[model samples]
Target: MIEVGSLTRRYGTTVAVDGLSFDVRPGTVTGILGTDGSGKSTTTRLILGLDGPDAGHVRINSRPIWRALLAAVRGRGAVRSPLLPPRSQRPTPSGALAAGGGMDPSRVGEVLGTVGIAGVARRRAGAFSLGMAQQLGIAGVLLRDPGVLLLDEPVNGLDPEGVRWISNLMRSPVARAP
Candidate 1:
């Protein structure tokens, strides 16, 4: 579970996330929605331990997120936030994921297939359209079969069909497992 309590962040004089608190229990899909400049991305980054909160705490599975930062960075609870760029621009979909350091290289094909981009597995991800790039990012997120998923604007550049596919993937039992 993700338990965020009294979380806050500031950029100079501007407040980004202010005392935000919430729990995302197992077997559920929680969304943080807001306008473009809202703190949604900031909150996700804080939860992922990619950014430090000025005040308050973020706990994942009863452990403060700092304790889990190593695992998180290693891909146990991978995040798919759009704000993060792909690992690289030059490698093919397969090459990029294989180079991510951990996990079986064989699983690269499986994730690509799962995201419906197996046909482009050998193509340079740099040349992909926005929607396909989104798929590539998702495939990277799934490389280690993450236990916690934090997707920000996951469907932003997707087509109608791609959006539906992502919606279904989020609702699937596999995605909801603790």
Candidate 2:
């Protein structure tokens, strides 16, 4: 479960999120609706521990996500950027493959396959179409098997088929499970 209590975020004099509170329970889809500048992305970032809240608390599975992320980082370095160059360009002999305990190189192929883009596994994301990039993004999220998903403009740039596929994918029970 993800819980937010009296969350607030401010940028100088501007208030992005004000005392926002909500809960995203397991086995449920809680959509955050708002205009482009309505703090939706800010709230998601706060919940994911990507940004600090000026006030309030956020808890995931009864533990603070920031604390958890910090701990994870302390133990295994920070998560690697998904935009890193492919194995062929890396300095290591392994090439573009993730070094150490980062994301599994084999899983990259698996996720691409899961998202129905296995044929383009070797292609750089920068060169992919918008829909293909979106699929890769979804595949990246699936890598962690998160119980709660927070998508920002998830349907952006997707074709009709791609949009439908994402809608069905998010509604599936398999997506709600940890």
Candidate 3:
């Protein structure tokens, strides 16, 4: 569950979000709808603890995400952004291979296949098409098996087929229950 109460954000003289409040309950998909610059992304950022609120508070599963992220950073160092390998290099880390202990390199291949991008799994993500990038992002999110998903324009660059796949995936019982 994610809850936002009287959340507000400002950028200099501009107020991006103004006194917003909402609850994203468990076991359901909640859509945050607004035009561009209407605080949609800002709200998501606040909920994810990527930004501080000038007022009000947000909570995830009854615990504040800001506090949780701070605690996580304190315990494990700040979470570093995942880096995509160079075009000439392998996408999966050598450490991943070491962790698998020389199992067929097909484990990563299988995950890519599951996301419908096995054919281009070896390709650099930097060079992938926008739709492919969206698939990869979805795959990354799926890797965590998160109970709560916060997607900003998730269908923005997807094709009809890809959009359907994502819709179906989000509507799956596990996602709904989570």
C-alpha TM-scores of all predictions: 0.84, 0.74, 0.74
lDDT of 1 by residue, 26-129 (tens): 78998888888789989988988889999999987778999967755553454354323454746787887888746576788888888899999898766777
lDDT of 2 by residue, 69-134 (tens): 654332211121233345455232122333422777787666556666778666555566667666
Once fitted onto the true fold, the runs of candidate 2 whose alpha carbons sit more than 4 angstroms away are 70-110, 122-126
TM-score of 1: 0.84
Name the lDDT value of residue 135 in candidate 3: 66
The candidate that wins on TM-score is 1
- Give the distance in Å from residue 139's predicted Cα in candidate 2 to where it truly belongs: 1.0
Runs with alpha carbons beyond 4 Å of true place in candidate 1: 71-89, 102-106
Order the numbered candidates by lDDT, best leading. 1, 2, 3
Which wins on lDDT, candidate 1 or candidate 2? 1
| Per-residue lDDT of 173 in model 1 | 73
Q: What lDDT tens digits, residue by residue, belong to model 3 across residues 77-162?
A: 11113334556653443233223344345555554566677777555456666666666655555444466766777777779998
Off by over 4 Å in 3: 70-114, 122-127
lDDT of 3: 0.66
Model 2 residue 89 CA deviation (Å) reads: 6.1
